[model samples]
Target: MTDHRYVCSSCGKTHEGLPTDWGFKLPDEVFDLSYLDKYRRTRSNTDLCSLDESRFFIRGLLSIPFTHREGEFAWGVWAEVSKATHDFYLENYSNEMAQGTKASGVLANTIPGFPEITGQALDIAFQNSKSRPFFSFPRSAEHELAADQRDGIGHNRHHQFLELCGHFDESEA
Candidate 1:
């Protein structure tokens, strides 16, 4: 069996186990077959996978896939939210979409139902530009404001994005 160990921060306790009851819904013929074949060989033995492969999986989410650049290139904004928030957003997303109106300027931060999705923005990324995309390590980095991250109205859209997601506090973003 795999020998990976995890420690809980709350109880200061350690435990050994594999992630259980995990399910991901993805499209058929999505993943790279070669990568899947290699992973299958070690599936029962370990949790190890190449970072480049992991980045490949993440970049697949991009609307426009450009392979001209090397390394990980994340495009667009994203946030990690709680399961409750995710479900709520999914259920009411259509309503929000229907209610959403076009902003006066190019990039408007406010969307009718975006806050519901972002309310529990446990982490966020400020990848507002195709160039200079944010590369998140194991966890989210500090909320340092960047040019593309800032909207036209003096508010950081990334910060606004966090607020819409539901964190009313400025520091939270």
Candidate 2:
């Protein structure tokens, strides 16, 4: 098995290590008892484990919605970023907000010579509407075209998540 490490550049905090697994959680405001129970039951060692207050970094991102056949109505987004790079973004995020600068995902494509990291979304969101709405990952022209054409509320959307994560692996990281 391969070991994957995700670090936060801003706070110098390390998230998961080796054999990396990714997951997302609902914001505190949207919490529900039923979902919390499910989350508690399904939680495992492979889930995203963190030691610091930092939540996430930036590498690439993708969102997919489950189809009617797969589930009623649910969606997921995944982000992959190395520690240093993510730290930079987190700083930028704070600066941008504090200075009233416009928020943009352009950095997702501008990092040069950094290994591309990808994430697998194995968890379901409690409130899909509250999930991250945009992805900040660099994408190939082909992917952009396919994503635009696909209706984003079914199995097709889920496949796009897999496609984005499939672009690279631990060796690239």
Candidate 3:
């Protein structure tokens, strides 16, 4: 796909390419805490996060295909995992054997324009040492996000997401 150019609504600057990936800097639960509480109860880096010394989370990519395009859009989102799964991930960090490892978790972000999906069941699969794990819904999941993932989304719907996230070409709008 060609690069998408858009004038950012938030910054009021002309951004050259449309971003295919969007992410949250922190999990919603931690993000909602007060400044002091967040720092006192959380320890996080780019890929892993721990809250209250008990809750564990890992960053992952959730990709949805474009119905009429050659590529997919991705969300760099976080997942809440069991302590055992989180420990296993840390133990296998940067190890090739970690590839294909699967774990059950819950989506940790409320994606824009979608109903509250923060606690939705999610399945994660590790790609390799170099890439973040990929997130998916269980086969039995019944939600709009799951349907979009399974059936693909139209270009217009994708554009709506871009706009919702403050990335939109005014000319097209």
Candidate 4:
């Protein structure tokens, strides 16, 4: 049995007991195999025997600043398309792309549902990004994914991507 000791932060009471006696839960850490357990369960049995062995990495990306502990919860909504979700969705991405006609000065006529999905993913990333430890973080950084925590997914590139997209002269190409 593992020895355990803990102190009550509010009551100033000191307690000592077995690790299991208190029944307190602990946060997960990086490099922990169990970190991705939640995502693993959602996968089909035919996919793979294990996550570490899988080509795609499992990430627990979160929108930062989820501090409204008493009010709204991030889980109340969704995280960006999980890396797995994004991978599983690869096939659908192209189909969502429109076949462009140069005559119209556009590549694809309409990306259709792609934009909506894209927006939702972006929103989730931004939410997690805002969940930072410091409030001084630049506003531009708000539209990003959380750090690549052991269990957290990192949505780092989205902002740079959005910036690039904003200035890209598709017509010149």
**Cα misplacement distance, residue 113 of candidate 2 (Å):** 31
Q: Name the candidate that leads on TM-score.
A: 3
Candidate 2 residue-pair clash tally: 6
In candidate 3 the C-alpha lDDT for residue 133 amounts to 93
The worst-scoring run of ten residues by lDDT in candidate 3 lies at 164-173
What TM-score does candidate 2 reach?
A: 0.26
Write the number of the candidate with greater lDDT, choosing between 3 and 4: 3
Every model's TM-score = 0.22, 0.26, 0.86, 0.16
lDDT of 4 by residue, 1-173 (tens): 54534454336675663111111011112123354663653332211112333322212222233221222111111222234543543333244232221110001111122232222222212112223111111223332232211123222332223234331233124
lDDT of 2 by residue, 1-173 (tens): 55545553335676553212223342221223366654653322221211233333332223433344543222222233344434444455434333322222222121112223223221111112222324422333234322432434544444344344442343365
Query: Candidate 1: where is the Cα deviation over 4 Å?
Result: 1-75, 97-148, 151-173
C-alpha root-mean-square deviation, candidate 3: 3.9
Model 2 residue 111 lDDT?
14
| Clash count per candidate | 4, 6, 1, 13
Candidate 3 per-residue C-alpha lDDT over 82-164 given as tens digits, one digit per residue, 9 for 90 to 100: 99999888889889988999999999888888747779999999878889999999879888879888888888778778777
Candidate 3 residue spans exceeding 4 A from truth: 1-17, 169-173
Better of 1 and 4 by lDDT: 1
Evaluated at residue 172, the lDDT of candidate 1 is 27
lDDT per residue for candidate 1 within 86-105, as digits (tens), equals 33333443453423221110
